[model samples]
Target: MNVKTEVKQIGLYINGKYVPSSSHRTFEVKNPATQGVIALVSEATEEDVNQACLAAREAFENGPWRTMSVAERCEKLRRMAEIILERKEEIAGLDAIDVGKPYHSTVQHEVPRAAHNIHFFADFVQMQGGETYPMEENFVNYTRYEPVGVAALITPWNVPFMLTTWKLGPCLAAGNTAVIKPAEMTPLSVSLLGEIAKEAGIPDGVVNVVHGLGSVVGTALTEHPAVDLVSFTGSTATGKRIMKNGADTLKKVSFELGGKAANIIFEDADLDKAIPGSIHAAFMNSGQVCLAGSRILVQRSIFAEFLERFTKAAMELKVGDPQNIDTKMGPLVSEQHYQKVTSYLEIAKEEKAKLICGGKRPELPEYLQKGYYLEPTVYVQENPKSRICQEEIFGPVVTLIPFDTEEEAIQIANDTEYGLNGVVWTENLQRAHRMSHSVRAGTIWVNCWFVRDLRAPFGGFKKSGVGREGGHHSLEFFTEAKNICIALK
Candidate 1:
């Protein structure tokens, strides 16, 4: 559980090389666990964004990366994955401090998952191929997939290490060069990827990392002329802004945006599993996850029993130092975000929802007093349209709603503008099928939560997101399709 207390400084990486910010300005990156300065990362200004874009463009247009054979690209990606695995502990430490994720979760899931994602894409792209069609006896038609050129990837702070690979894995696999802008609050772990790329022999300018506020560097990256596509993972509001900015260039924009997912438990379900499942879904990463099941819809038949068990499990969550392997939960990403989440608790009170457990911060030890912490919060509301039910709190908060029937549960689940993820807990095969078909979400976990297949399509519906990213879906997004026809006598 020991961590470094000394402050360090990090730099931006452009053209496969580390360089200071163009403006020579620096920003402080903090450990959300203790509110202590973790490192001073270069603050990438608009000019730095432009420089990174230029480097990416050069790499995509005339660099060896784009010209390399598919096998060669896969090999490089495997090397990078190996490097990531070898440094998993080191990376997990940074992730634990930077994002306030539990050390156990970071080391067990986030760190290893990132390395696996890269390897998945490396082999995934190799197995993927364009199709050839038989047109006529005298003619042949075929399809080719080409890189989308420069990609602008903007990752959020909550899952910086995982989401970076989520975008970069297939991006580089499909032969696109990129400039990533890690969230200002957590840039340390992502900035380290530049070194991993260099170690893997990923060519210069193939991958770039710029660290700064989203408004400055994010805007520049989205609007840059050389950028062909912009892939963003953050709030829905910011996703809308990126779409507007990239529209001028007619660039393709893919988003994995916000979600207020619903976890529906049927009366026939196993409460033993559903209780912990519901709690874990809502409180994972202190509820900073976009796909967090913030809404729990219970069948009216078992609503009382479910709420009692669910609240008990939520209240038992240990919220303290993320560095502790036994810690079940950690603080919010920052003081500002902590306020945003706590403000919603007041709204819940005003709306007259029953505050079952956790509307206040937990008492911490002396050394952790400065950390931004919030206890697991559960609210029971009869009205599905309540603000607490409708909005994305993006914290450890969940609103429990009761639904009369399967149809009502489906209606309540799909009632939101966001449809990123939905969960259904039912033992009946018929009910599971009906709920899965009826609830509108990119991912629906039946009898389980947060279980994922690397090859499955991952994204959202409605305003949750614009496109999917996983397996071949990601390769398609990062590349464009071209058709070629040949005529013979």
Candidate 2:
């Protein structure tokens, strides 16, 4: 818990330089692993957001970025990826301390994945080409893709580095200038992105980072008329607000929103694989992931035994300081989020749900006593229609439900308004395919979980989100298509 880390003051990256907020106000960035303030970051006001938007618009309209050849744009992104990889350790440490993510997960998965995201888009930009078709004997038709001008990328807190590049990579690869507003809760790692872009030799105003609370800066960024597109990753409720605000300009909006995925484990499943995969789906990132399979649906025959094994695994999860490489679960992102999760525990109790394991905060190491920690909570829902069964807790809490038939399992899984991610654990390949098809979700995992290919389209089906992002899907979203018709003489 006493791991040494470098601390420095943080500021907004406007145009091509790091600067203070116009209002000169700042907020503390705390280490959730120890509840210590590690740095102070400038809090952008409405004015600051406007300035960033103006800069993005200017860059898109008048700067070399938009006019740059596709190969040139891709080269810059590739260079940024190299810079990001060079600072992998530092960024991983920052993510671990900034968002209370386990050190190993950050170091092994998030940081490297972010760098790969940049490079992936770079490759996409290089490989993708325009289309040409012969319409009639005397006419020719062709289609070309162009950048969507200024794009606003509003990313969330849980996985800052990964999500930052999720939006940034495609935005840059498509030759669009951008203004990024990282969630105020976890801003350290993304605040450094501007520096990396500058080092990568990206033209000025191509990428900008503004920091502030969502209510102030987020609203301003989405509502700005000059912004041609808004790509936001956050809660469903907030995504709705962004949609409404962006309606004035009819700006193109892309959202990757909330998810309450149902992890169904059938009686025919390989318990060894199913058990750990389901538990991991629910508990990864301390259950803070939007794709966390928080709802567990078990075949009635194996309900009791599965619950017992799942409870034991949940209890054994190492809950403590994120700085400890051995820790399996770290603290929640903030005191507010901790309270929200705990409040749901009380709600489960009131609704007469069974608390099989972990309903209270774990005793932390002496140095981390003040950290916002919570035990991995498992609940058995008596009523399938209960709020605890339907709502997104966004913490290390999962609800178990028993299903008698495959039809019932599919019904329960698709009952929620969210259709983000789902899992079906079964040895029977036919059943796996059926359940995966039956469940209405964007991503389906069969006998596995969280396995991503980066090339496939990723997005939610219903209230979860709008549009897809991954590989060429992302590149397409960041760009606009124009068809040209020519007559041959």
Candidate 3:
């Protein structure tokens, strides 16, 4: 455990307490930023997962959380949000250590937003809707939003704390109990969330955590008969599998999965505005974000110039220790992922894409040892259909492809199977609006890139996976509808 002060060990959380998993098996969480092991986490088995699920089910069926009124529940969530705000630094520090998230960004961007998200959902739920019926039946009719009991939340390692809040907030707000299965790689920060919830007076077993591999804990949670809903964030392939297993009981399932987003930059775009935003979109979090604007679509007129600007901007990004506030980027999560990314470099080379900047691992920086690191890379390709153009590298890499017309830009943007998000960069308000409608992605960003507001619904259209997270639209993910009828005579 004697490594960087930035990496630390983590324990599992269950029934309002932190403890090791019954199954002593463990996994290492690698910091993508440093490509180093940040924490060693306990791996939960099927039995352990069942224990967590049963705890959540019991809480939902008979515990204080389920018994609480909407107003009471909202109060609890607000209290939890307050507790999070009070302990923001400690939790933010945990995120930087456990996941190698940039501390400055984690503090200013992720942590506050997470706390606000819980509060926002709490406020949103206070206005829970039930429609008054104009029924012709022998009974009066209405509909109330009811929580899907025993929610199984399987969150990814990338944005562990924030995604945990996203899954936890509306779930509790909707009166459901949750068994959260944090990815083995990034389990501790979420465990800390469990701690904060406990301190904020979440009743025992209201929220439980079992840290482990997806195949073990994740499958168990999805397949458990007692679990009523499964919310997952990961690959599209894994989301499909979760849906299949949850279908055994026909449980309600929501997925926020993979993305190969297209970021369209037109000739009319203000390159001054678009270049910086595009660089951030393509390279933020080292481009590991599911909605990272990975595919850069530029009009033929501006393609060369945009490439130059984008390449310079990407190179300008400083990748180092995420704990450093001045560091703009970091390593990929692990050597495995870094290798996967490097392989993509080979593929890009075979496809005849020009490497405008980095495509290989950087020599050891003076400040770090024992972490996987890759230099930021930019690829310029003549063919939009190149393999590098379509595949998701999920690294600090950018592909610059040229498009001839607005129609072709839309076509290229919509060409991918993954459509989580896309950006249309044009000063012309009309063109921005047009392609926003035309793109097949779940979220369409016009002019601005990666400015993800909490109110906007986020998800993908085709292969980006099913269901939406965030926005007023998120309530549907945690709720099921029921109609009550009575005669209006």
Q: Can you give the lDDT of residue 359 in candidate 1?
A: 87
lDDT per residue as tens, model 3, 220-263: 88999989888888988899889888887999877888888888
Off by over 4 Å in 1: none
TM-score of model 2 vs. true structure? 0.98
Cα lDDT, model 3, residue 382: 76
Residue 236 Cα positional deviation in candidate 3, in Å, after optimal superposition: 1.0
Q: What RMSD does each model have against the real structure?
A: 1.0, 1.3, 2.2
Model 1 reaches what TM-score against the true structure? 0.98
Candidate 3, lDDT over the whole model:
0.80
Where does candidate 2 clash, by residue pair? none
Distance from true position, residue 45, model 3, in Å? Answer: 1.7
lDDT tens digits, residues 1-489, model 2?
Answer: 344555668999999999999989999888887777888899999989899999988988999998878888889889999999899888988888889888877878888899999999899788888889996588898988899999999999999989989889989989999999999989989999988998998988989999999889999999999899999999999999999999999999889999999999899888899888877898889999999989999999999999999999888899987877789999899999889888998899789999888888798768888988888999999577888889999999999999999999988999999999999988888888898889999999998999988889999999999999998888788999999999997
Better of 1 and 3 by lDDT: 1
Error of 2 at 207 (Å): 0.6
273, model 3: CA deviation in Å?
0.6
